[model samples]
Target: MYDHRKLGRELGLFDTDPLIGAGLPYWLPDGAVVRHSLEDYIRTVERRAGYQHVYSPALGKRALYEISGHWAHYDEDMYPPMDVGGEQVVLRPSLCPHHAVMYRSRSHSYRELPLRMAELGAMYRSELSGVLGGLTRVRCIHLNDAHIFCTLDQVADEAAAALALIGSAYRAMGITDARYRLSLPGAGGKYVAAPDMWARASKILGEVLDRAGVPYEAVEGEAAFYGPKIDIQVGDHAGRESTLSTVQVDFHQPEQFDLHYIGADGARHRPVMVHRSIIGSVERAVAHLIEQHGGAFPAWLAPVQVAVLPISDAQEATAARLRDRCLDADLRVRILSAQDGSLGARVRETRLVPYQFVIGPAEADDDAVAVRLRDGRRLPALPAGDVIARVRALVQAHDTRLWD
Candidate 1:
């Protein structure tokens, strides 16, 4: 098994300092590059899907989670309410309660039947010290979260649409080795005992999965406190399945929080809410990518896409010019000065970068550079302008390939 923590450390992506506390990741510059790129990609995908982005506070009053039933149902995993100037508050563990409050912030009409709200929310959990493992299990998390408040008649379609969105994202990320689990309330006290609501919501979710042509296994006792959910399990390089994405249909929250919308009849009616996270944790996703691809990220997601190496001090000017050109073309690149390392040493370092180029007297005189790809394929000298344009297109298109 490829251990992401070890790989991440070796790749200089992120670090966890014991002094700062366990499970908190501090992203180095390289890691931030990848993190920012992934967030941008997700935002682009979400905006195109009609999601209205929003930001919510990271902490809330204890009564907030109580209203959402998390305090009662999931207290063990949550930190005890903190005393902030005599007021008891909690470091938010989930984005649902805040989002629910946002939904209740203003009255809504039936026209806003499927009001989808999203956020890059932060959450805190009280994981047992022994149980905390890298990004997968953590105290702090940056959640890629969203909530859809819809009418009962719109729930099924909205559920199906959520599944489609998750499926599209997985496909785009080349995550094909996965399965679905439809989790329902089981024999545990973990779930809220709204039996009638559970039956209705579970049936609706099952129907959505069936209509969407997705295969799923019914898992007992895995549903959230609010409702039933469809959790997608993606396998790592070693085939160990882990939950990656989820679409949770919430029934208890809407009723508990009294979230409603004006119907066509001008009467107040409860709006059902669905909580979905296509990418559960940005930190965990980076960790997963590290292990999945052995830290050799695709061109679009690699921290450093290209490295420019000068053959000798004589080629320093050419390397400098090429570096400027790469930057002007918006390519995430670095130039290897002669003082940095030997040409051979720098070439070996290109394993971390998808593409690398060598500039020397002949090539510089010809206004060209010799290219080397991650796969050890060395190509003939090509014009600097042509190389710049080629890499830019690959980056803009999010191409996985190192070369066109």
Candidate 2:
């Protein structure tokens, strides 16, 4: 098994200081770059998919969640509300309620039936100290969350679209053999969702999956309090199933929040809500990627895609020049010009770096680089421009098979 906590320490991805607290990971530089890459990628996809990104406070008034029904149903898993300055507030554990408030703040027409509001929002969850693990089970999380407000008629299409987005993202990340679970409300559970609404919501989700020919198992009592959900189950490095993504239908929130839009008949009508997350936690996603690809992230996601090692003091100037040029070309490159380390030592230290170049006396004289790949392939001396061009192409195209 590829353990992320072990590798995270060795690779300088993240760290947890007891003084700071448990389940809170401080992202190191290398780890931050990977997360930024993922954030950028997901944001691009969301933009193309017509999601309007927004920002909301991580702390909200207790009355906000109360109005959304989370205070009554999910209060146990939430941080206790505290009085800050004057009024009582709680660190938000989910982004949906905040987003629902945003929707109700505005008046919309039927033309905006499918309003996709998104945010890379921070959330806080109250977890037992023992269960707090690495990025996977953290008390604080940056959630890739969004909520879609649409008419009841648009529910099936939106549900299918969310599922398609999940499938495409997993494919791009090289995650394979992931299964789907259609989670439904059961007779026994702390469900805020009404019984009649539960049956209708579950039936709608079933029809959406059936019409799309997606095979999924309907599990009783696995549904969220708002409604049933379509959960994407991906196996971790240890072969345990983890729910990394979800598409949930919420029939209660809009009603509780009194969200309304002008109908085609020009009357106020309630809109159905679809809560979706392609990746629940950005930190955990990076952790999973590190394990999935064994820390040799695809060129696009690798923090330092290439490192330049000067064979000797004589090659330091040339190495600096090459590194600067790669940087100008927007390529992630590192210059290892420390004379204390030998060529072999530096090379070994950078084994996890996707690509590395050796600047020897001969290569420096020719103004070229002797390229080495993480997969152990050696390439002939290539001009700096060619190296940058190849790497830039791979990054732009999100290509993983660099050697092939």
Candidate 3:
């Protein structure tokens, strides 16, 4: 079992200290590179799917969640509201409330019924210290969250599409062990007091799973307060299961926020909200990737995609030149010169790097580099331009291979 907490520290990916508090691990430089790449990939995918991105403040007026029903049901997991200029405000625990307000900010026509809004936004949760271990549970989280506002008639198709999107993202990230779950409302005061709404939402999610022809377990007591959701579950090295993605059908928030759109008949109609998250929280997603890959991430997600190693001082100048060209090509690269250590030692040090470009005296004179893959495969020394272009193509395509 590869524990992320162990690999994270050994790889210098993230750190948690007493001063920073528990459940608040800060990302190191390498970890930030992985996160930035993941964020960029998600943005591109969402944009291609027609989602409009936005940014909202992390703090919200208490009334915001109150209107969204968090104040009434989910206050236990929320931070205490602070009085600001005689008005109380709180760190948002979720982004749906703010997105609801954004949707209400303008009148919309039915043509735009399925309006998709996405945000790689930050939110805070007041998790108990005991349950907080590494990134799986955290006080602060940046969620790849999005909400789709559509008509009742559009709910089924929109929910189905969201499920398809989640599956596609999982496959791209090389996550193959995830299972589907139908999370329904269980007996609790945590759920909203809308039985009809719960029934409708649960039915829609169950059908979505069935229509998609995926096997899933219908579990009670695991749903969000406002709605039932399709949870994408993955197990860790310790066999502990956690949710990594979700697609939820929400009819309650729209009613709470009075969100509406104009129909062809020119009458006002309430919109249904479909909540979806592709990778859930960035921290947990990276943590899972660390364990899944055992710190040897896919080439596209590797923190340092390439490391240039000069066998001797004779090759340092050529190595630096190659590094500059890689940087110019927008590749994540670093030069590991002979001064650091022997060629073999340097190669072993950056073994996790996807590609190690070793510049020997012969290769430098020939204006080429010998490529060493992370998995111990080797490619003959080739022209610097060929290596750079191929690596750029691999990264841009999100390809898993080191070369063709």
* Best model per lDDT: 3
lDDT of 2: 0.86
Candidate 2: where are CA atoms >4 Å away?
211-215, 237-239, 338-340
* Tens-digit per-residue lDDT, 17-134, candidate 1: 8998988878988889988988888888889889999999999999898889999999998888889999889999899999999899998999987999999879998888886767
The digit string of per-residue lDDT tens for model 3 on 1-404 reads 48999999999999999998999999999899889989999999999998999999999999999999999999999999999999999999999999999999999999987999999999999999989988888999999999999999999998898888888778778888999999999997999989999998898889889999999999999999999999999988889999999999999999999999999999999999999999899999998998899888888899899999998898888988998999999998989888999888998899999999999888988889899998889999899899899999988888777787
TM-score of each: 0.94, 0.93, 0.97
Q: Is candidate 2 or candidate 3 better by lDDT?
A: 3
Clashing pairs in 1: none
Q: What is the C-alpha RMSD of each candidate to the true structure, in Å?
A: 2.0, 2.0, 1.3
lDDT of 2 by residue, 1-404 (tens): 48787887778889999999998989999999989988988899899999999999999999999988888888988999999889999999899989998998889999987999999999999989987778778999999999999999999899889888887777667766677899987775478747788888888888877876877888987888889998877666677677788888888999998889999898999999999998768977877887787788888888898899988888888888888888887889988876658888888888888889888888998888889999899999988788788888878776676665
**Whole-model Cα lDDT of every candidate shown, in order:** 0.86, 0.86, 0.92
In candidate 2, list every pair of residues with a backbone clash.
none
What would the TM-score be for candidate 1 when compared with the true structure?
0.94
Sorted by lDDT, highest first, which candidate order results? 3, 2, 1
